[model samples]
Target: AQRVTQPEKLLSVFKGAPVELKCNYSYSGSPELFWYVQYSRQRLQLLLRHISRESIKGFTADLNKGETSFHLKKPFAQEEDSAMYYCALGGRNTGFQKLVFGTGTRLLVSP
Candidate 1:
């Protein structure tokens, strides 16, 4: 079985402060990691994918194969960035898409 873990359930940071969300994964095979965020009263959306190598909303995450980690980072955070963030692992068997998500971390950006 594969699992994704977000040790922090809640992260409170001031606006304009740097932030980093820790994520760890356990899997036998190669893992496809992703960060999904859900804003206030908004649907969950992809923040970043390990394969994309792109930054969204001023946040970026790089997959550390050796450590089995994919931590999200942002040089600066905004009040609007307050949201529920989840670390997800995507794997496949045959034609089926299997995913395991972390408990989720709620980021509170205080003004």
Candidate 2:
């Protein structure tokens, strides 16, 4: 079985402050981790993937297999960055791609 856990339900930060959203996972086989964000009244979109090793909108997440974690981080928080962030795990299940998502962490950026 595979699972993703996001301990914090809400994270509040002020503009220009650093932000970190923690995520942990458990899986038997190799896992693919991803970060997804959903803005207010908008559809969910992929923020970054561990395999890509790229940063989007100033957010980045690195897969730490030894620690079984994939934490999202940003140098600075912006008011427009406020949104719902979800950590997802992807792997092959019976020859098909299976994705397991965490409950998610809501980010609130204040001015």
Candidate 3:
């Protein structure tokens, strides 16, 4: 079975402070990790992907095979960055390219 686990349900931080959303996965084969964010009433969008190794909206996540973790990070937290963040895992082993998402973490940035 494949699973994505985000231990923190909520991460509160002050403006300009650093932020980190922890994500861990359990899978038998190589996995593709991604971060999805939903702001206000908007639909969920991809924030970053491990294979891309690119940063979007000042956020980045790295996949650590040894630890089976892909944690999202940002040096500074902005009010607009507050959103519902989800960690997802996908791989060929799944047969149909289905993504398994974690419960999700809500980021709260306060002034």
Candidate 4:
């Protein structure tokens, strides 16, 4: 079985604080991992990917094969960055054309 799990429904914090969004996945084979973010009144877009090893909008994610996790992290939370975050897993066997997403975690950045 293959699945992605995001443990939090919401994460609230003050501006300039560190942020971490936990994600865990279970898959049988090599899996492509990604982080997608949706801003207020905007479309969902790819934040980062495990394969690319890139960082977007000051956020970075590292894939840990040993723990089956790919956690998103940022040194400081910004008000503009506040939005809905989702961890995703992509594998050929899932039958989905793209990636399969976790439920999502709402990040609330307040001043």
Candidate 5:
């Protein structure tokens, strides 16, 4: 069985402050990890992928295979960055597009 958990239901912070979104998962087999972000009115988009090791919109995430975690982080949070984020896991006998998503963490970036 595969499962993902985002500890915080909401994370509120000021602009320029550092932010961290906690995520933990449990899976028997190898799983592909991803962070998906949805800005104000924008559609949910991929923030980063553990496999790519790339950062998007000032945010980055690293997969800790040993800990079974993939936490999203950013050095400076921006007010415009306020949105909903979901930690997801993919890869099973299922298709690539099929993903299991966390409840989500609401990032409230205040000025």
Candidate 6:
């Protein structure tokens, strides 16, 4: 079965610290990986996608097909960067592609 794994449930870091949210996935075929984030009072939204190779809010993620991993990274953390991040995998199950979300990682940035 295809699965998305986020081992860390809670991560704490100080302001201006480098942060990395680990994510690993398992699937049979090519997958479209994405990083979704939800701020304190905001709705869940896309942070970035593998194909875009773009960075949103100083965060970047590269999909490693060989390792089946798409890890989110941020050079410097900020208080507002604190949020719940989710790693999602878009893969074909039967007839269409479906999104499989990880458990989620709650990042807390301390001042």
Best by TM-score: 3
Residue-level lDDT of model 4, residues 1-111, one tens digit each, is: 779999999999999999999999998888999999999999999889999998888999999999999999999999998899999999887776567899999999999
TM-score of 5: 0.93
Candidate 4 segments exceeding 4 Å error = none
Candidates sorted by TM-score, descending order?
3, 2, 4, 1, 6, 5
lDDT (Cα atoms) of all candidates against the true structure: 0.91, 0.93, 0.95, 0.92, 0.91, 0.92
Q: Model 4 TM-score?
A: 0.95
**Candidate 2 lDDT for residue 105:** 99
lDDT of 1 at 62: 96
Scanning candidate 1 in windows of ten residues, the lowest lDDT window is 91-100
The C-alpha stretches of model 5 lying farther than 4 A from their native spots are: 93-97
How big is the positional error of residue 14 in model 6, measured in Å on the Cα after superposition?
Answer: 0.5
lDDT of 2 by residue, 1-111 (tens): 688999999999999999999999998788889999999999999999999999899998889999999999999999999999999999884137767899999999999
Evaluated at residue 66, the lDDT of candidate 5 is 96
Least accurate 10 contiguous residues by lDDT in model 5: 91-100
Candidate 4 lDDT: 0.92
Error at 68, model 1, angstroms: 0.8
**TM-score (all chains, Cα) for each model:** 0.94, 0.96, 0.98, 0.95, 0.93, 0.94
Candidate 2 stretches greater than 4 Å from native:
none
Error of 4 at 58 (Å): 0.7
Pairs clashing in candidate 3?
none
Best by lDDT: 3
Candidate 6 local lDDT, 1-111, one digit each (tens): 888999999999999999999999988887889899999889999999998999999999989989889999999999999999999998675228668899999999999
Where does candidate 4 clash, by residue pair? none
